[model samples]
Target: MLRTPAAMQDAERHTAHNYHPLPVVISSAEGAWVTDVDGRRYLDCLAGYSALNFGHRHPTLIATAHAQLDRLTLTSRAFVHDQFADFCRELAALCGKDLVLPMNTGAEAVETGVKVARKWGYQVKGVPAGQANIVVAEGNFHGRTTTIVSFSTDSDARADFGPYTPGFRIVPYGDLAALAEAIDEHTVAVLLEPIQGEQGVVVPPEGYLPGVRRLCTESNVLFIADEIQSGLGRTGATFACEQEGVVPDMYLLGKALGGGIVPVSAVAADADVLGVLKPGQHGSTFGGNPLACAVATEVVRLLATGEFQHRSAELGERLHAGLRALIGKGLVAVRGRGLWAGLDIDPALMSGRVACERLMERGVLAKDTHGSTIRLAPPLVITAEEVDHAVAQLAAVLAD
Candidate 1:
């Protein structure tokens, strides 16, 4: 027996069952590939669910992280660290927003967005106190926080975790009519993912995002785009909304914002919407710490250059073309934008889990979202040949 089985057993024995990861034990990773302890290499198609958009241990990100580690690391929210202002200012400028509130995770950013929206509704929009509600889309995967999950339509995420928080209304995704009907006088914000990553990378129909933007504008409600998984150059743009020519009231960002080095998330919005918060209202301890800010500032600068965005756009077309060619063979459908794609393997052949297991055996690492749907979000730094290699592995797996 190889060393992997024993390592896998040890991992399962010690950790919680929150994630059902593949059996491969990754020892190290660089760019678009990872190495197992047993010396096997695998193409990384998941890219840490878009968190590794810059690829594993990107040189610039790594250098900044290393330098920050040698200096100060944390100072909490009480005293502002040296790295905080640059990160907040640069990230805010990137989003075309006036203010940015840093947080530790995507879920915290969502929660912060919710709180900010409610506060803005009461303070700015003049909604009735305690009657503030937010509109959300079905099949959304914001995060697993109690408040965030309160609006979730997924039973797996919402069930057993509730006695849920109130003040959220669920509407069908990609349906402007349903969304318009769901919003009321008390509705403060409309929160949605431009592309639903966890829900099989579902893309809304054309004009859906712009329509949502229009409705939110007309209704005087905030349009908060949860771009945690779709932003930071994953969708051929700094944000997926940019593809639709829509600028939301707030941008909830995470994942790639930390350059896959540290946990960093933020809610960016204009002064009018984000300024509703006073000092004591909301904060995070390690949110804009020196280490996180050092890495993420470089992340913002990289994004500002628009290099990754262009790469994702060009590479995404090639990826989608390759995937669409396989639709009639083993894939039922392929959906996504930029470097992100969700492929539905024919269920008659195998489930997404089985297909992923087979792909792993063929030296590629991908993730399954739904029953027969697997998501492919390789790093933006991946090469054309690597893309072809990953697709070829999938083709071979399906053929077998």
Candidate 2:
């Protein structure tokens, strides 16, 4: 087995240099802990960017996947499989939506939602063809597709990725007035992340989501929530939008929906809204594959129990209380919801990347986004003791 630095160098030389990941190589994971190539263990505070809400290799999900694999892996949407309808029904029930369109990735789900919104705008909302407008919030990271990136506010993601797709309007996040002002007669939908995770877990101002819901309803515009990273109990709720008790017209869900095993995502909406697309209008070959559906069905059931959500809420309070106690010492601020937290370091102290490296050296793993903010989202299965250990390691790094 090699040390982390050696393995990291190998990846840098062989893999695409797209991500500036921490110099740690995990070889195995279970629950909230991971083992590096060198056999060193660390608390996985990042949890694959909230893709492991059920934790790594959750027994239920793995068993379901195994059984499904033994029975059937993929049938492609060209043919329906036994697992498809069950998955869709469970997901729709969990979401309290009328219908669900499965996809393989978060970006694909987002694309599905975008297509639905645009089509609904034309066919149902009666907006002119090619004139539909969707208002998006600033600092959003919906996906990497050209159309999705077109509305991105991050220069790094959008730079050199154009000529971008059109039909989008940008408004400052958490600013209801600006959002309302941006809406026009051609506006078909308003898309936003209930909590901006990629932007360092940037939670909106209180009541922002509720206000947006009202605005969308009043203006007769569809409200679409990109909950790819913040949904599925990541924010102490089935969906972050639920915190404000507002239901969007459609939901873009991914990340943990696959039970941290496969890439499973979906767009859930009412029949009239999602029904805009007739057969042959849109789909993916592996969208409703038997394997993904089998796994996701279990995932949806797990979310329905509210066990993970309650765990996140209780653990989040403890984690935040611990991190918040460090504020004004070395941490500038800590902001986030549920299991997700962002520790903003003071400029005078080490940068988030630096702190992350130091914490890794002390047996914990978390990722830094932007420059000064470290985002932590451990698997929901992590216990209070493990949370304490991770936080203690971070505190030790700050003290050093």
Candidate 3:
């Protein structure tokens, strides 16, 4: 018998019941595929929620990690390492920003962005001391941090988490008029996801982001784009904001930045906004460690070449076209851009969890979110054939 059952039971017994993972116990992965302990291979469509945007164990990223591991890893931000400056500089250049503050996870970057925005509001924008507010979309998913969840519109994430952190105003997403009305003299920033990944890969209306940019500029409020999930090569551009030709004042980035090797995230902005912090104000122990910098620098280099972005753009057309054909068949709707997509299966047929389970039985790995919606964010390294294969598996699952 395979060790899969025993291993899974052991994991369940030892760990917190936070995540209800699929039944597969993967032993190894490469590119866009993973193998179970039983030697069953499955196509990886979730792609670590876009963290593996470069694909599993990418050669360049792995090599960089290996090289750095042989020499040094963490320095705790106490002293600068050799890999630090280049990583910061290259990422800053990529973002068209003057500075980059590194953090370990997407949530931390969001928190960091919040802190900086508030500080900027006080020091630079002359907002009242404790009255600084941030306007966020209703269905936004920045992360699971306390401050982040405080403003979350999701009951699962917000309920029982507080006496929530104050000063955040929630407004309906894609409503330019509502957002404008919510902003006041105390508004410090407008934080939003260029494409909301968790809310079923929700894409806002076309002109929404550009309008936000204009409003933020006029109001002297920072426009912080939470690109943790929608950035990198997932949306066919380095950042999803780039799709709308909107450059936010601050970019909160994570996921693919670490090249699937380590937890790495950063907030990038120009000197005027980011410079609000002095040395002692904000820091992370493992933020810009040697191993993370080494891996992320290589990730930046990969993005700089624009190969992955191009692949996502071209392949996304094929993926979207294939999915759109399924709308009336079993899918209720399909929404997203590039290699990222959210498919809503007809709830009468199956829930998103059931659909994912069925897809898994057919040798595909995916994730479900919000009722009957399942998200597909295959790595940029995935081939056209693999993309078709995953879709065929979904069709088969739905047909059954």
Candidate ranking under lDDT, highest first, comes to 3, 1, 2
lDDT of each: 0.94, 0.91, 0.94
Per-residue lDDT of candidate 1, residues 233-313 (tens digit):
999999999999999999999999999988999999999999999988887778788898899999999999999999999
Error of 2 at 187 (Å): 0.3
Residue 74 in candidate 3 has what lDDT? Answer: 86
lDDT of 2 by residue, 198-268 (tens): 89899999999999999999999999999999999988999999988989999999989988889999999
Q: Write the per-residue lDDT of candidate 3 for residues 150-229, one digit (tens) a residue.
A: 99999998899888899999999999999999999999999999999999999999999999999998998899999999
Whichever of 2 and 3 has more lDDT, that candidate is 3
lDDT of 3 at 254: 94
Candidate 1 vs candidate 2, TM-score winner? 1
Ranking by TM-score: 3, 1, 2
Give the Å shift of residue 385 in candidate 3: 0.4
Runs of candidate 3 exceeding 4 Å displacement: none
